[model samples]
Target: MAEEKSRDCCVRHKKREPDQYRDMINRLSRIEGQVRGIKRMVENDAYCPDILVQSAAVTAAMKSFNKVLLEDHIRTCVVEDIKADKEGTVDELVRVILKLMK
Candidate 1:
């Protein structure tokens, strides 16, 4: 018979708290504005270097957002499962880390 999986071992994981979600949404909203601004800059024939700098800022903001979410996941879901010795939890975490690195 196939081995049973832990209850928490699934593709979908726990969600962030409302405050965290809101923070992410706010960051994304700013990024959306930045994207629109980039389009305007292109249309107005703005300096290429300025546009590249703004694009870099947007990328940094997105990476910051991702870091926050990853930290939360490690502190909450991954820690709890690892402490409890949940089946395949460590493996899953390692896989996620590898995927993120790539």
Candidate 2:
């Protein structure tokens, strides 16, 4: 009932299993470190193309992280929402996908 009430309040926060939470946090931590490395490269006057390559690597890593999270959302949140017959979950999912595509 509390979960439903929260959803009705339009502030749904999915409860991630511990393992999933840890994995997501690990990915974000790696990305944060990569960003810090890029900042150091900039401060040290690293070559532009080399910096660009590293930037691209960071972008790819971020996309990979998004992919993992999206897969989990579909497997867990979307599945649970649909099973519960919560209204507009599919539409909300569509909006999210569209935003991601943009």
Best by TM-score: 2
lDDT of 2 at 78: 91
Alpha carbon deviation, residue 64, candidate 2 (Å)? 0.7
Candidate 1, 1-102: lDDT as tens digits: 133455444446567779888988999999999999999999999999999999999988888877887788889988898899877877887897788777
Per-residue lDDT for 1-102 in model 2, tens only? 999888799766888889989988998999899999999999999999989998998999988998898888999989998999898889988998899888
| Whole-model lDDT per candidate | 0.84, 0.90
- Alpha-carbon runs more than 4 Å astray in model 1: 1-10
TM-scores for all candidates: the values are: 0.74, 0.87
- RMSD (Å) of each candidate, 1 decimal: 4.4, 3.5
